[model samples]
Target: MKPVNKNDRLLVHVEDLTHDGAGVAKVEGYPLFIHGALPGEDVHIHVLKTLKSYGFAKLLEIENASPFRVEAPCPVFDTCGGCQIQHLSYEGQMTFKRKLVRDAITRIGKLPDVPVHPVKGMENPWRYRNKSQIPFGMEDGRVVAGFYQPRSHQIADTDICIIQTPEADSIMAGIKHKLTEMGIEPYEEETHRGQLRHVVVRKARATGEIMVVLVTKKKKFPQAAEALKLIQELVPETVSIVQNVNPEKTNVIFGDETITLWGKDVIEDQIGDVRFEISARSFYQINPEQTEVLYGQALEYANLTGNETVIDAYCGIGTISLFLAQRAKFVMGVEIVPPAIEDAKRNAELNGLSNTLFEAGPAEQVIPRWYKEGKKADVLVVDPPRKGCDEQLLQTILKQRPERVVYVSCNPATLARDLRILEDGGYRTQEVQPVDMFPQSTHCEAVAWLQLAE
Candidate 1:
């Protein structure tokens, strides 16, 4: 077989999609990932790089187009790294995400018989994100705020983003303009010597409340009062304006110090009937509409009859715990972040929920201790991070043998792997439901239901 070289122009038939939404084409069984290509399309690609087993290419021309292809509406779609698969139609995205879950369970988990449901998609997928974290940088001696370029830290200057809420876009643009007029320097990552690093915006969909967080390189925000005045006048609905200082050089968005520049420190939002108070660093779900759907599926899987105790692992701000408490005899939540635990307790008190307990500690350590203290769980619910559940936590769950295990996951591969471990530990995989939490992007969320072997 002739080895493909860089800068080689080749015509290939696109066959499948990678996990990140790039199209796959093969030359003699050597897979070449092409950006912006889709399945069932014949495309001309310029080979960018080649490896021993696979290659990377750039889409040059579409000789044939798939019926599922659509015109991407975002002007910066090609450069911004915020989203992928926007060129594919929403219906096609749903089908692809559903297949993603199914393929992972069948191939990774080795559970071909486990039922995976069709993806629950949004009625309108665009402008669904309630949160936006735009990096601030200087381009051509002017302040710019937008997403980074694909796989790179270079900011793609954008005035608008379709996935983010309209209020967030307006507020971000207003602050960027005001700060630029005030001669505020955007953070220089290479030198770490500038003032502003990022601007994060969060909008509550139900309440129309907004929060604007300015991440700075130092504790002192230059022209703080004037900047806050401009932001408030521009976006009057904004209820919170915060400043977070990070003196150290790092890529992380938030720092240890957060101070309210104006208004309240926290903003209120709701998922279904439960209310939550969100702070600067709270791990609230970005998409509120689909969070209701995802959690609703989890609630359905629990099948609580108000007489069983439930344990919520990795419960951030008591969002899932509060939901479970409404229908269970008692609910206990465990989290690793202390601030998030405080927020959880505050939220529980705000909702007047007395049947719940929130503790700050690692679930792997805390849940086992609860079991030792004679606190049993009839249902176990976990909404873990993208890395999925910890091994020790999985072992603890298996040892406790909760009658029902409701696993909420953001990564299908890890979820499948963990499910296989649980299945081997005497649990039966019942069903999986995929939800499009981050629409117009490649990320997919799923809730899995499992039961102890009969």
Candidate 2:
């Protein structure tokens, strides 16, 4: 193989895509990852860095474009790190996501026979995000708020984001402008001195209610009332304005202190018939429309018959627990975050769902205690974080041996790894359904059905 170095330009054929949406090319079996190059396309790439095992390249020219490639509509599509694969057509994105799931299971999980279904995608794959979190920074002596650039702290200043709700975009833009006019200094991460750190906006798609959170460096915000008034006037849909004080010198967005500047601290939203109360630090899904679809798949896979007891692990705000409760005899949920448990209980009460119970603790510890207390789960449902289920939790699931296990996952690689462990413990992998919860991005959500082997 010829030696490859930085600044060496070469022509290669894109053969595959990585988990992060980067295209893969090979020269004499040596892998090279190139951004902006789709599968089955011939492109000229400039080698950015070459490693012993693989190399990184930048797409310079596409000699042959794939039929699935589409022009990204966002003006900052290239610079903004908010999304990847926006240049690919929506249909192509779905196909690639489905392949991602299948490949992960087949390669990582070593489950080649598991039936991975086609991805369930949105009819209109744009403007689906219900939440927006943009960092506040100063550029050219003016306050700017937008997402951070790819792999950097530098903010990509923009007036609008195509994925977020229009109301959220307008609200952030209005707040940034108003606060700048009020001389409210944007937070500087270097010295940790300014007042404003970040702005988070949440919109309820069903009720058209909005919640705006101003994350600041200190509790005292100068000209707070005037800025709140300006935000309210600019976006009439905003029903809640909150200030979250992060006095520490850290990268975390929210601090321990959350004060409501005006109106309620929580906003109401619904998925199907179940209602939820969303707060500033709530772990609500960013896409509600796809959430309904994703949870519906979980419900379908659970195959509740109105007589079984269901246990939902990592159930945030009882979103899926309530969905299961509608058909099951009883649903018990466990989460690590105490505030999420509070919100879950409130949501359960708001929907008049008495068949569900929520507890605040780590699932691995709490579920074992529940097991000793005679609480049994006919069906075990887990929607764990991207890192996947804890090993102790997996061991507990195997020991308890629920008749059915419905796994809802955001990361296919981790999902496959967990599924392999379950399959080894006598669970038969039935089917996997991928959902496009995040459109125009590389992330995909999936629900898998596993049955106890006879």
Candidate 3:
């Protein structure tokens, strides 16, 4: 190791916790985040960069180890950026996730009355990921596939990812080898003329059938057909193959053109005996097992009695809306994306569900329009995107005053902010639960049930 640059050096011990990684000690009464270190560990850190309030660092040594600290299994633990808490014990990870949600509600959202239960961790953390999105990048002048490194734009070449399903890992060697053999050009960010962008894989746990979606920058994905054939030959259990073209320069995913190469354009999966059809662009929880539990919790909080009408706002492909329709008199799902709404209707019809309906529009707009016609939604379930509910949607919900409001959020920071608005609008937080959908990562999903405040 190179000798220390003392000019930037600042030693500190971590005191509390941050959602990102490790918490840090106060140096001269200023908090400095000590990376690669665990809580309750005293460590000497070299401050790399200083911010206005806090600073970042690299751990020089661990003077004391936290009880929760455990050696991460993967070689790419800190580098790949896929999982952050691999160094943390499974039990401790759950504790940290729960506390983070509680703290977010209490401090960030300023909602102290709300109670957040201990975050639920997976039974078998490894092989839990049923879905994988592998980006294509050039390495050593050859096309390669793997996940990107932590907080960086560069993609790292790795074959084995411990978190995904066994089927996902099985096809890795073949996919990489074929992509290299075909000499498919990797997508260059500057030119945006590459034939390969990403290789998305999904597997149904119940059926053991896999679906591979090839994402390219251009429409002519001749390599995808050859690659899919090779993948099928290697693994015949692959039920379907699909392709999508993403030409946008931005990192955000909105597959510009979707084409199914073989089999079905949509993949099928079951959650708690209930089957669901998900297209390539549709949103389904990456972790299927945990999603069942989450839906159970949301349903419990909803207190549905089989006689009420439920409206699932921001319902992507009717996952929850269709699930609730089985019990409720009628379930109506609303989504902004047209493709997702179409998928929801097809899924509902495929499952022989007749009571649920899906529409395309903003929730705020839909909720108000429905209210004008005197539609009494006894229960309203909202599964919003990361940004959380908008102001107009909040106002519409309050005006309608549904018997119960179930708000499921992926971003706790935004969830907390929206909860405050709900509280101000006379809605009381009934319960909040956190689900550790993505282990080792800093992000978490939270559900907040609200009703008219007394």
Q: Is candidate 2 or candidate 3 better by lDDT?
A: 2
Instruction: State the lDDT of candidate 3 residue by residue for 142-258, as single tens digits.
Output: 666668887886777777888876566667657776766786777866566667777788887777778888777777766666777787887788878887878788665447778
lDDT of 1 by residue, 1-454 (tens): 5468899999999998888999999998889999999999999999999888899999999999999999999999999999899999999999889989999999999999999999999999989888999898888878888999988999998889999988878877887787767868889888887898988999898898999998988897668988888888878999999999988899988899999999998899999999999998998999999999999999999999999999999998899899999999999999999989999999999999999999999999999999999999999999999899999999999899999999999999999999999999999999999999988888999999999999
**Candidate 1 similarity to native, TM-score:** 0.98
lDDT by residue (tens digit), candidate 2, 1-454:
4467789899999998898889999988889999889999999999999889899999999999999999999988888898999989998998899999999999999999999999999999989998998898888888888898888888888899999988878877887777766878899888887898988989999999999998988887768888788888878888999999999998888999999999988999989998888999999888998999999999999998999999999998889999999999999999999989998999888989899989999999999899999999999999999999999999999999999999999999999999999999999999999999998899999999999999
- Arrange candidates by lDDT, highest first: which order? 1, 2, 3
What candidate 2 gets wrong by more than 4 Å, as runs, is 1-3
TM-score of 2: 0.98
Candidate 3 global lDDT? 0.80
TM agreement with the true structure for every prediction: 0.98, 0.98, 0.94
Q: Which has the better TM-score: candidate 1, or candidate 3?
A: 1
Pairs with steric clashes in candidate 1: none
Best by lDDT: 1
Per-candidate local distance difference test: 0.92, 0.92, 0.80
lDDT value, residue 183 of candidate 3: 66
